[model samples]
Target: MDHTAYIAILSVAFLVLLQHLLGLANRNGKNKSRMRRPPTPPGAIPFLGHLHLIKKPFHATLSRLAERHGPVFFLRLGSRDAVVVTSAALARECFTEHDVAFANRALLPSQRLVTFDGAALGTASYGPHWRDLRRIAVVQLLSARRVGCMSGAVCAEVRAMVRRLHRATTTAGGAVTVELKRRLFELSLSVLMEAIARTKAERPESDADTDMSVEAQEFKQVIDEVFPYVSSVLWDYLPVLRWFDVFGVRNKILAAVSKRDAFLRRLIDAERQRLDDGDHSEKKSMISVLLTLQKLEPEVYTDTMIAAFCSVRDSFVAQAEIDAAVGHSRLINADDLPRLGYLRCIVAETLRLYPAAPLLLPHESSTDCNVGGYDVPRGTALLVNVYAIHRDPAMWEDPGRFLPERFEGGGRAEGLFMAPFGMGRRKCPGEALALQAVGVALGSLIQCFHWGRVGGVEVDMGEGSGLTMPKAVPLEALCSPRAVMQDVLQKL
Candidate 1:
């Protein structure tokens, strides 16, 4: 019995030794690959090397880092080795030629729970699941052709927006200080709700259909509560305090999720009933498409999956255009869309200056590879500083200025210099739709009204905290109907 036991123990130990040997061999191979390549210069620091220095409003901070460290440099972001690609040339290396190895995403805590385990395209890792979801979203939901079909929806919504804005203009209160943020945010919400729910808020008619103010209040409360939870926080990076959540953050998120889910479920149930009753005209939305798909191919689509898809698509679509409305103005329209090409420039320029995700969502190195002549180990997290690349003084004439003309007449888009939509396989698929949405909306606002700062209030260009870089003040202005449209405005 003792002899047999000894043999079994010896065999187990032998197998463990073999595994360690192979692991060491792999590590050695990876190290050799790095030695043969150009490594980025390490910033000066001890255990938390380069971590404390690179902080947020990251574009400005990284610009300074680039001045000190050059185009490519290595730094420690928490325990991770982040290879910062600042210049357009380095950006190209990460996105173009060496794209495949760096296509996977960094797993953050908030994104995991909020996005239903990263099934949505924006936060999902680059793979089959992401590709499939993106294909579904672009082809079925956000394609140019599909978005064009939404013009009727947009016109109807804008008419309501005009009605509301005109009401504000004529309110006898004398030059109302319009919060463009409130108007634009509502415009965006209405469009998104109709696109996904296929119904607008019904005007109060009789007692039975009387709108519940309490329900409306609850829904608004839920949305306002959830706005701040999308950001990447210190706990998101640390992971140790995730359960604790630091500031009752987890409870707030849980409450918001519960409220949001309840509202969405009610909408889904209503849509289902509408479909059953042959009343498809009023309730044909993106949710309906997903539901229809789920029913027809039960094996492929689940209800939870449909819910996640709807939630994320709504979030991205809703926030996509407002990113462009930083300037003090109101609703943009078709008449103004063509004339305000410079506004498109501002949107593109803003994306360059303050890209939605400055770090561009972390990507993992799938294989040991060489980048900027440095050996990158497999599983290395890649943080491509799109902000740094866009503002690299070498790429543009006056990189710091808010100029839109730079994109015109053969501007600096040669390499990866102006990759606001990202590059290669991971480029944002909703880019065309986002462009049209921003262009048309901004253009219309500029065309329909004469906009000025409220009470001669200075337009604050300060930035705020979020995954998306939104303007701090959220745009405030005084707007009046144009001279030509005054008669039309009066009739309304």
Candidate 2:
């Protein structure tokens, strides 16, 4: 090589080394001024940082990482910084002490389109707008009194499920293999439809109940297709990819949004027509109630705002209430759910073992805050691993065992953190409605059917990768109508 060329290369290399040294010194100075951050897991690569470590079924992967790191650990995921809380105490601290500081949701390129630009209550930024939506939902829709009024809808849906299952068995002249997840989803959809649009199966065996209606199918398809994209998209994490639409994610998402909006508009327009016709009914469906509110406050309760509630999506997988209090002579109803202790225990245990959302939606810190004695800088994402906390051996005795009896005496054992729906400001507001629906749906199934594992083999409890951690294999079970409830089902 020429002497002059060699010298030029050396000069550039020396300058690069000097800049790297200065960067290190700046970081050291910042560390001295700020409190220590939680320890980070090793093997973080450039650009991606710890993104490579995040495997499918995020909560489980993070739980394993926590075992190796600690209950509270930091992760640099692509461009974002995140803190995972696997311990109850630390999680409680984050919610109670630093609640407001960590109330904002981490901004995502996909959520903007998916949630109508943070208009949906679940993904809305913590502020007056979110507060208003929460209030309207709580007061007019999910309030105790409102949920009670909605009990009839829950009962109607559960009865439809029972009747459908019974017909399936008779078709085969014996217990038939059934997909419980499909049945559960159908029942949930019918109930929600009735609430949102007063739409129900014209007949007990109609497509809406036996099979998902096209509307329900489209709705479910949109959620299953888009939500996972919203939560875990490389486009959201990497600005370069997001800018160029490298993966064409934007087009796919818009297609889903168009389908979803078309569905919501149908529901809204139907209710609007009913109102215009002057058919004032005593039992107003949720959409009807919102339209009523819109008349009072048009600005706050616009069609777009009402559509947001219809699109919450958090309530998509929600249900329970029934048995001893009502007895077999009469069917169990929503009014009976509160007194059914053992049923409540069973529901609690189910949620504990398999929470709907194992990892609660991530929270973002709006400003610098101290969590578990470590400084979490502004914009740091907070993930509370409710799954690990629920199953922690230190927190619960024999946590792995399926023990409904543990929740029987009194209520949850004192101070044990068992948050299936989550905690703090962002706790799922559908808890009241979901618990009632599940109690009735589950109790009705148990009352009207004899269920068993398919082929007498243990169920494969392996979970699939997704937002809700669905079963790897859909639940297949043998079921037949109970002899005692045959007459009652026949009447339906």
Instruction: Tell me the lDDT of candidate 1.
Output: 0.65
What is the per-residue lDDT of model 1 for residues 1-492, given as tens digits with 9 covering 90 to 100? 699999999999999999999999899878666464433445546555566775666656766777776776666665566666777787788877789988877666665766777776767777788787777787877776667766666656665666566667777444556787767766666666667766655643322211223334345667787767765456665556677765988777777777777777787787778778876553357777777777788766666666666612322222343335322234445334444445656667667776767667667788777777777777777767777777777767787776666665445544427776778777877676566655666555544556677777677878775656678778887777655455545554
The 10-residue segment of model 1 with minimum total lDDT is 311-320
**How many residue pairs collide in each prediction?**
9, 10
lDDT at position 115, candidate 1: 70
What's the lDDT of the predicted structure labeled candidate 2?
A: 0.82
Candidate 2: stretches off by over 4 Å: 1-33, 201-214, 311-324
Evaluated with TM-score, which candidate comes out highest?
2
Question: Estimated TM-score per prediction?
Answer: 0.78, 0.90
lDDT of 2 by residue, 358-471 (tens): 988889999999887888888889989999999999988899887777886765856667788777888788899899999988777776777777889988899998878799
